[model samples]
Target chain A: MPPTSIKSRFGSRIRSLRDDRGFSQEELAERAGLHRNYVGGVERGERNIALENIVKLAKALSIPTRDLFTDFP
Target chain B: MPPTSIKSRFGSRIRSLRDDRGFSQEELAERAGLHRNYVGGVERGERNIALENIVKLAKALSIPTRDLFTDFP
Candidate 1:
């Protein structure tokens, strides 16, 4: 929407998923061993995280890491 | 090691990527329109972000969304 990067796009998706599940950043972070701020950055498409964390994120979020890219390019 | 979730895995990935790029959570958040805490959550593998956000994250991180899952299951 804003000529965003992968981070921004992923950030939007993350927010949607979180909202769909009625989860707060803090709640998700607690379960994922992550910081709420990091979740926010991801939602806003502001990060460049690595692979291992991707798996960690998928597990914590109850989604597969591949799911994060279910519709990726 | 912790049977971590996707969020945790992704969170770890994010941290590694950020560390690799020599960036702090705050720096990435500012660029991605995300909250730094949220970025931290993702790096710690704590969130179930959506596909779109994944793209944004990958972009912000200068990676392809598909690459996010380059080593995913």
Candidate 2:
């Protein structure tokens, strides 16, 4: 199998974190002030994900931006 | 004082890491397969910075992408 892309890994990371927080995609999107579809895209690894959006997600998740990348390969 | 933007903090982090690695902006850009001007813009906090480019820079720096956010506020 091809190695997982970092985007996929990052997306999985976000999904896992959202799960840990018991957040629905809509809730997370609301908290991040992003469109629900945009949040969905990021979680699905379909977005390139700019730093600003990353920061918004981190803020919404109540974690340091660095923590968003914890255990990353 | 106004709070520093995360973009600026991230940019400074990259610059500091580049300095620690003893790399000129051009050399680092070359390693990351990015344009020197683009790298310069990133370091200047003038770019929003996509995840793929972030990964490229992390690989070029021989660091985990998480390490790029070390000591982030």
Provide C-alpha RMSD values for all models, in order: 9.8, 1.0
- Whole-model lDDT, candidate 2? 0.91
lDDT of 1 by residue, A1-64 (tens): 4665666656676677778778899987777788889877777777776554555566777876
Compute the DockQ of candidate 1.
0.18
Candidate 1 residue lDDT tens string, B38-66: 78877766767654455567777887666
Error of 2 at B21 (Å): 1.2
TM-score per model for chain B alone? 0.84, 0.95
The sequence of per-residue lDDT tens digits that candidate 2 reaches over residues B1-73 is 9987878888999999999999999999999999999999999999999999998999999999889888664
Candidate 1 chain A: worst-modelled 10 consecutive residues by lDDT: A49-58
Per-candidate local distance difference test: 0.70, 0.91
Clashing pairs in 2: none
Which candidate achieves the best TM-score against the true structure? 2
Best by the lDDT measure: 2
Least lDDT summed over 10 consecutive residues: which range in candidate 2 chain A? A64-73
